[model samples]
Target: MLPYHDAALPVADRVTDLLGRMTPAEKAGLLCHAPVAVAPDGGLVDEPRTLLPTAPTTHAVRDLHLRCLTLMAPVAAGPLARWHNEVQALAARSMLGIPVLVSSDPRHSANENPLTSVPSGGCSRWPEPLGFGALGDADLVRDFARVIRAEYTAVGIRMALHPMADLASEPRWCRTAGTFGADPDVVGALAGAYVAGLQGDDLGPDAVASMVKHWPGAGPQAGGEDAHFASGKDQVYPAGRFDLHLSRFRPSLHAGVAAVMPYYGRPVGVDGLAGVGFAFDPKVVAGLLRRDEGYDGLVCTDFGVLTDATLADGTVWPARAWGVEHLDRVDRAALLLDAGVDQFGGEWCPEVVTDLVAAGRVAQGRVDESVRRVLTLLFRLGLFENPYVDEGNAVATVGRADFVAAGEAAQRRSMVLLANDGVLPLAEGIRLYVEGVDRATAERYTTVVDHPEDADVALVRLDAPYEPRQRLPEAFFHQGRLDLPDDRREHLCALAATVPTVVDLFLDRPAVIPELAGHAAALLADFGAADEAVLDVVFGRARPEGRLPFELPRSMAAVEAHPEDLPGGTRDPVFPLGHSVEALDWRPRTSEPQKG
Candidate 1:
C-alpha cells in the first residue's frame, strides 16, 4: 500500500506523503469548500436546483478535483447515506483517490429558517442552540453534541459546521437563535462542552470534528443588521467589547476544535485592525487568532466571501468580501490566503488558488501549509481507511427512538416562563381557545373552543416579531424591527379582553413585547418547540425550566437605543437575562382577567 494510504502511519507522515504526491490542481481543490445538492431518490444531483450556491456534483468532484464540500439540501437518513456513498465512490475513482470531507450546517434543530439551519429531515429534532443556552447545563449540551456526532458520522458527515460560539449579544441579529445566549461565560461553557462531546477527549475515527464558527463573535452588527449584505457590513464595537466577543471563543479553542469559521463583518473600533472582513483581515486571522491567541487549527471563511453567487431563480447573493469588495477574485483569493484562511466556503473556484500560485501572488509553501492541515483532519478522522458508511446503520441510528425522545424532552424543558399570574399549569377539562397550535394535540389536554369569548381560557401561540426585508435571502433572515405590528398587538389585546389568555411566543430572537406582556395573562418564551411540546408544558405534563438567554426590550425604542456591542444593555428590560418563573401547582381559578 502507498504510504499515504496506510492506516497505521502517523497522521503527519500520511499528510506529508500525500502533500508530496499531489499536483497543483489537486491542492487547489482541497481549499475549495463548495456546496453540493442531493437528489430526492438518493442520487447525486449535478444541477444547481436549490437557491444555495451549489455546483454540479459530478463536475465539482471529478473535474475541479474538489474534496471538501458542504451539504445544504434536506434529505432523509437513508437517502443521505446513499448520496454520501455515491459521492465517495466517485472520489475513490479520481486520480489520487483522496477521500472527500463532507460538512453540513446545523441540521439537528427544529428551525426551518434557511439562513441558519435546515429543517430536521429524519434527524432528531431538538430546540435551537439558544435553548441549550437557556438551560445552561453543560452536561446536557455535551449529551446533545454526542447525539449530533453520532447521527452525522452515521451519514458520513465528518465535519460539523456548527457549535457557533458566537454570542446573542445583539437582540435583533438574525443569527441569534444559532448562538448560545448573550452571556459570555455561559456561551463559553456550552461551547467547550459541545466541542468536547463532538471531538471527544481526542479526535479520531469515532469522532465528528467540530468547526466552532464566526470567530470573535458575529454578534454586535451595526444597527442590529447582519453582515451578510453590503448595507449591514459594519460590525461596530462602540462599547469596546471586542475583547468580550473574543472571550467566547477561548473555551472552544481550549477544547481543541478542528476548525474555525470567521465572520464576514468588517471590524469597527477594533484596535490596530483593518476595517475588512474578518476572513480578509490578517490582524484578525493571523495576529489575533493565530498569533496572539495561539490557535493552530484550520481556518475557513464564511460562505461566498470570494465571489458573488447567482441563484437558479435569478436572485443574486452578493459576495460578502465587505471592506475588500473593490478587489478582483484573484486578488481577493490572495488576500484570504495571506490572511491565513485555509478554505473558501461556498466558493467552487479552484482555479483562483491555482492561478494565485501560477502568478506568484502566493507561495507554494503557503498552499502546502493549508493542504497539510486539511489532510491531517481527514487522516485523523480515518476517512482514508473508510469514507463510506453503512446505509443500514445510518437508517437505524438516525432519529432513533431514544434520540428523538431526548430531543423532545429538551424542547419541553427549554421553554422560559416569562410571566405568570396564577393562570398557568392550566387546570384540566377547561374549554380552551388556541391559535398556532395543533388542534389534535390541544384536544388531548383540554376541550377545544373556536372563540376566546366562548372559552374558559385561551392559549395563543405567536412568533417573536421581526420586520421582513423585501429581498429573497435577506428576507429569510428575521431582521429589522422587533416590535409586533399595531394590528396584531391590538388583536391579542382584544383576545385577552374577551378571556384570560396564555401566550407562548417563539423567542428565536428577543423581541419588544411589553404591550403583549401587559395583555397576556401568562407569557412563555421558546427557542424552537413543536405544538405538542408547547402543550406539554402548558398542561403540566412537562415543566418550563428555561431561563431567559437574553433580555427582552420593553419597546422598539429601547432596542434601538441599546448598545449592540454590550450584552444586557437595555435600560429597563421587561424580562432581564436569567428571568424565568417556577411552575405553580395546577389549580382551577375563576375565569377572570388578571392585569399583567
Candidate 2:
C-alpha cells in the first residue's frame, strides 16, 4: 500500500506520498470545496439549487476528483449516514480512490439561521451559542462541544465549520446571537475549552476536527453591520486597537484547532496590510496569520468569497473579492494561492487555477503545498481506511436520550429573567392565558384561559423586533433598527394592562423594547428556548440563572451612537449586559452594561 493509504505511517508521510502521485488538475480540484445535493433516497439531487449549479455528486467525485464538500442541508441521521455512505462509494470507483471529507455549519441550534446553521433537522437542538456564553462558564462550553462532536461523528461529518470565535463586541451587529458574547477573556476561555472537547487530545477517527472560523475576528464592523452584504463591506477598527479582535483567536492556536476561516469583510489598513478581504490579502493571510501568529493549519476562505452569491430572486451579490474585484477569475485564483489559502470555499473553479499554473502565473509546487495540507486532514481523520459508517449505529448514536436531556437542561439554564413584578414561580391551579405557547402544554401548570381578562396571569412569547427587509438575501439577514413599531408596542402594553403579563421574548437580536418592557409585569429573555424549558423556569421547576450575553439597547439612537469595537459602549441600554433576576435569592445589579 502507498504511504498515504498505510494507517501505520505518519500523517505527513501519507500526505506527501499521495500528493506526489496526483496531477496538477487533481490538486486544483482537491483545493476547491464545493456544495452538493443530498437526496432522501441516498441519491444525487435531481432539482437544481437556486444559488449553486446542478452537478451530479458522482461528477464532482469522478470527473473533478473533488474530495471535500460542504453539506448545505440537514436530514435525519439514518438518511444522512446512508447518503454519506453512497457518496463515499461513488468516490471509491474514481482513480486513486480518495474518500470525501464532509463539513457543515453549526447544526446544533434549535433556531437555525440559514447563513449559519440548518433548521429543524433532527440534530439534538441546543440554544444558540449565546446560551453557553450567557452561562459564562468554559466547563459548560466543553460539555456542549462533547455532545456536538458525538452527533457530528455519528452522521459521518468529519469537519465542523463553527465555534465562531468572533466576539459579539458590537451588540447591534446582526451576527451577535451566533457568537460567544462580547468579553474577550470569556470568549477566549470558552473557545479554548470548545476546541479541547471537540478534538480531544489529538486528531483521530473518533475526533471531529473543528475549523475555528472568521479569524482575526469579523465582529468589530464599521457601523455594526453584517459582512455578508456589500453595504457592510468595511471591517474597520476606529479605536486603533485592531489586535483586540484577535484576543479570542489566541486560544484557538493553543488548542491546536485543525483549520481557520478568514471572514469576507475587508480589513482597511490593518497592521499595514492592504484594504482587502483577508483571503485576498497576502500580508494578512500569509504574513500576519501564518508568520506572525504561527498558524500552519489549513486556511479556508469564507464561503462564496471567491465568486458571486445569488439569491432566490435573481439578486446577485458580487464576489466578496473586496480589493481584487477588478481582476478576472485567473488573477483572483493567483492572488488567493499567493495569499496561502488552502481552499476556495463555495466554489469549484479548478479550471481557473489550472490555467494560472499553465500560464506560469502560479507554480505547480504551490498547488502541491495546498494538496498536501488537504490530504493530511483526510488522512488524520482516518477516512482512507474506513470512509463508510454503520447506518444503524449512525441512526442510534445521534440525538440519544442523554444528549436530548442534556440539551434541554442547557436550554433551561440559558433563560434570563430580565424583570419580574413578584408574579413568578406561580402556585399550581391558577388561571393562565397564553399566546405563542401550546395550550395543552399549559394545562400541566395551570387552568387554560381563552381571554386575558378572564385569567389571573397571562403568558406571552415575543420575538425581538427587526425591520423586515424586502430583498431576497438581505431579508434573511436581520439588520437595520432594532426598535419595535409603536402599534405592536401598544398592543403588548394593552395586553399587560388587561392582566399582569409575563412576556417571554426570543432574543436573537438585542431589541429596543423599553416601553413594552416597562409595561410588562414580568419580562423574560431567551436566546433559544423550547416551550417546556420556558415553562420550567416560570413555574419554579427550574431557576432562571442565565445572565445577558449582550445588552438590550435603549433605542436605535443608542445603538447608532455606540462604537462597534467597544462592548457596553452604548449610552444607557434598556437592560445592561449580565442583568438577570433569579426566582429565589435574586440580586439586581443596577447600572449600564459594564465589564466585571
Candidate 3:
C-alpha cells in the first residue's frame, strides 16, 4: 500500500507523506475554503452565474483539489445526497483520490437565514440553540445533537459549522439565535454536550465533526450589532470581561471539538489581543486559543477574510478587514497565516496564496503546517476509505417520522410563559380571534371569531422587535434596535382593551415591550416553534420547560444604557433571565407596575 494510503500508519505520518506529494497550488487550494456551486440538475458546474455565485464544485474538487465544501443552498434530501456523492466522486478523480469533506452552517432549525443557517428542507426541524438554552437541560441538547448528527450523516454532511459556543450576552446582536444563552455556565455545559453528541464520545466514520465557533467568544460586540457588516465590526469589552466570553469554549475543547472558527469582529479594549479581525490577530488565535487554551486543532475564519465580495445581484460587500484594512490583501493573508489560522473561508483564490509563497512573503513550511491539519481531519474521518453515501438510505432516514417527532417535542419544550392573567390552557369552547395564526389552526381549539370585539379571547402572534433594514441577504439577519414600533404597540394595547388578549411573541431577540406585557391577559415567548408545537404547549398536551435565555429590557432606553459585555445589565428588565412559569392557570402576583 502507498505510504499516504496506509491505514496502519499514524495520522501524522500519513499527513506528512501526503503533504510532500502535493504541489504549491494544491496546498494553496486547501487554504481557500470556497463555496461549491451545485447545479439545479444535480450536476456540478465550474463557474455559474447566480444570485449567490461562486466557482463550480467540479472545478474546486478536480482542478484545484479542494476537498472541503460548505453547502451553499438547501435542496431535497435525495437530490442533495446524490449531489454530495457526485462531488465526492469528482474529488476521488483528483490526483491523490482524496474525498471531499462536506460542511454546513446549522440547518436543523425553524429559521433559515440564507447567508447563515438554511431551513431544514427535508431535514428535521428543531428549536434554535437559544431555545435549547431556555430548556436548560444539557441532556436534551445532547439528544437534539444526536438527531441532527443522524440526519446530517445520512445526507453525506460530515462537518457542522456550528453549535456556536458564543453566549447571547448582547441580546440585540444579530446572531443571537445561533448562540446558547446569556449565561456562560449554561452555554458551556450545553456546548460540551452538543460537541459530544455530534462527534460522539468516540470519533470515527459515523461522526459529524462539530466546529465549535466564534473563538474568544462573540458575546461582547459594541451596540449589539453584528460583524457581518461594516456598521457592526467593532467588538468592545466595556466592562473588561473579555475572559468571560472565553469561558464557554473551555467545555468545547474538553469534548474534543474538531475545529474552532475565529469571528470576524475586531476586538477592541482587550488587553493582549490586537484590534485586527480575530483571524488576523495572533494574540487571540495563537496566544489565546492555541497557547493558553491548549488547542492544536483546525482554526478556520468566518468566511471572506481575504477579499471583498460582490453578490450576483451586483451588490458590493466590503472586506471585513476590521483594523487591518490598511494592509494590502497579500499582506493581510500573510498576517492570518502567521496568526495560526488554517483555512480561509469564502475566498477561492489559490493563485494569491501561491504567489504569496513564491514571493517569499509566506513560508512554504507554513503552508505545509495548514495542509497537515487539513489532511489529518480527512484521515481521522476515514474519508479516504469511503466517502459516498446511499441516496436511497438517505431518503429513508432523513426527516423520518421519528426524527421529526423528536424535533417537534423539542420545539414544544422550548416555549416560555412570561405573563398571565388567569386565561391559560386556553379554555376550550372560547370564541378566539387570532391575527397572525391561521384560522384553521385556531379552530381546532376554539370557535374562530372574525373580529376582536366579537371574541372572548384574542390571539396575537408577533415577531421579535427590530429596527427593520432591508439589504438582500443582510436584510434577513434582523439587527438594530430591539423595541416594538409605536404603531404596533398601540395596536397590541388596543386589542387588549377590546378583549382578553393572549400574545405569543417570537422571541428571537429580547424584545423591549413593557406596555404590551402589562396589557396582555397572557404572554408566551417562542423561539422558532411551529404553529402545532405552540398550540400543543397552550392546550396542556405538552409542557413548556423553557425559560428566558436573556433578559427583556424594560425599555429601549435601558437597552441602550446597559453594557453589551454584561448579561442582564438593564437598569430594569421586564422579564429576568431564567424566568419561566410552569403549565397552569397563572395571574400576575401584583397589579402595580414593578421592575422584574
Candidate 4:
C-alpha cells in the first residue's frame, strides 16, 4: 500500500506523501472547486442544467482531475448517497485514485434561496440561522449542528459551507436570515458552537469540516445592499467599526474552523488597505486573516470571482471581481492566488493555474503551498480510506423521527413574543378568522370563521416587508424597503378594528412595523416555523423562549439613519434587541432578562 493510503500514519505524513506524488495538473485541479448538478434519478447531469457553467461530472473528475465539488441540486438522501458512491467509484479509476471531497451550502433550513440554501428535500427541516440567534443558546445551536453533520456525512458530504459568521448589522441586506445576529458577542458564541459541533476537536470520517463564511463580515454593506450585485459592492464602515466586524470571527477561528470564505464586498476607505473584493485583497486575506490573526486553514473565495458569463435567458452575469473588474481573467486569478486564496469557488478553470505555473507568472512553490493545505484537509477527513456512503444508512439516518422532532421543537422555541395584551394563549374555544394560515391547522385549535367581523379573534400570518427588484436572479434576494405596503397595512388595521387580531410575522429581516405594533392585539415573530409550530406557540402548547436578535425599527427612516456597520444604532426601535414579552399565562422565574 502507498504511504498516503495507510490510515495508521499521521494525517500530516499522508498529506505530505500525497502532495509530493501529485502532478502539476492534479495540483491545478485542487485549486478549482466547481459545482455539480444531480439528475432526477440521482445520477450526475451530463448536460447543462443551470445558469452557472459546469463541466460534465465525469469529465471534471477524469480529465481535469478535479477532486472538490459542491452540490447544485437538492435531492433526497437515498438518491444523493447513490450519486455520491457513483462519483467516488469513477474517481477511484483515476491515475492517483484521489477521493472526491463533496461540500454543500446550508440545506437543512426552511429558507430556500437558490443562491444560498437548498430546499430540505426530505432532510429534517429547521428554522433559519436568525432563529438560533433568537434562542441565544449555544448548546442548542451545537446540537442542531450535530444533526447537520450526521445527515451530511451519511450522504458522503464531508465539508459544510456554512455557519456564516457575518453579523446581521444592516437590516436591508438580503442575506440577514443566514446570520446569527448583529451582536458580535452572540454571533461569535453560536458560530463557535456550530463549528465545534460539525468538526469536534478533530475532523475525521464522522465529522464534516465547517467553512465559516464571508470573512471580515459581509453584513455592513453600504445602504444595506448585498455584495452579490454591482450596485452593492461597497462595504462601508461609516461608524469606523471595521474591527468590530472582525470580532464575530474570533471564536470561530479559536475553535479551529476547517475553512474560511472571503466575501465579494470590497472595503471602502479602510486604513492601509485596497478597495477591492476581500478574496482579491492581499492585505485582507494574507495579512489580516493569515498573518495577523494566525489562521493557517484553507481560504476559499466566494462563488464566481474569476470569470463572467451569461444566463440561459441571456442576462449578463458579471464576475464578482469587484474592484479588479478591469483586470483580465488571468491577472485576476493570479492576483487572487497572491491574496492567499487556496480554492476558487464556482470556478472550473484548472488550466489557469497550470498555465500560470508553466509561464512562470506563478511559482511552483506557491502552487505546492496551496495544494498542501487542500490535501491536508482531504486527508484529515479520511476520504482516502472511505469515500463512499451506504444508501440504506443514508435513507435511515437522514430525517429520522428524533431529528425531525428536535427541529420542530427548536422552531417553536425560536418564536419571539413581541407583544401581548392579555389576548394570547388564545383563550380556549374562541372563534377564529385566519389569513395566511392553513384552515385545517386553525380548526384543530378552535373554530375557524370566514370573516374577522363574525369571529371572536383573528389570527393572521404576515411575511415581513420587502421590495422585489425587477431582475431575474437579483429579485430572488429579498431586498429593498422594509415597511409594510400601504394596502396591506390599511387592510390589517381595518380587520383589527372589527375584531381583536393576533399577528404572526415571519422576520427574515427586521421589519419597520409601528402601524402593526399599534393595531395588532398580539404580535409574534418567527424566523422559519411551520403552520403547526406557529399554532403550538400561539395556543400555549409550547412557550416562546426567543428574544429579538435584531432591533425592529419604528420607521424606515430610522433604519436609513442608523450606521450600517454598527449594532444597536437604531434611534427609535419598536422592539429593541433582546426584547420579548411573555405570554399572558407565563409566570416569571426571575426579574433579570435571559442572555446567551
lDDT of 3 by residue, 445-537 (tens): 657879877787788888898876777658878888888888988999998998889888988778988898889998999999888777766
Writing each residue's lDDT as its tens digit, candidate 4 over 1-596 gives 99998999988898888888989999999998898889768998877888656668998998999999999888998999999999999999998899999999998887867889877767898999999999899999999999999899999989999989998989998899999987778999999999999998788779999999999899999998888999899999989999988879999999999999999999998998899999998999999999999999999999999888677678888999999999988899899999999999988889999999999999989998999999999889889888999999999999999999999999999999999887777765677899999999888877787977678889999988999898867878899899999999999999999888999999999999999899999999999999999988887788898999999998888889988999877997999999999654753121221111
Instruction: Report the C-alpha lDDT of model 2 over 226-335, residue by residue, as the tens digit.
Output: 88877788887766757888767989878999999999888875668788888888887898789999988898988877677655557786777777778876788788
Colliding pairs, model 3: 46-56
Per-residue CA lDDT of model 1 for 106-164, tens digit only, reads: 99886776666766668899999999999999999999999999999999989998989
Q: For candidate 3, which ten residues in a row score worst on lDDT? A: 587-596
TM-score of each: 0.98, 0.95, 0.96, 0.97
- Poorest 10 consecutive residues by lDDT, candidate 2: 587-596
Candidate 3 stretches with Cα past 4 Å from truth are 584-596
Give per-residue lDDT, candidate 1, residue 246.
Answer: 88
- lDDT of each candidate versus the true structure: 0.89, 0.81, 0.83, 0.90
Cα lDDT, model 1, residue 397: 94
How many residue pairs collide in each prediction? 0, 0, 1, 0
Q: Least lDDT summed over 10 consecutive residues: which range in candidate 1? A: 587-596
Shift in Å, residue 326, candidate 4: 0.9
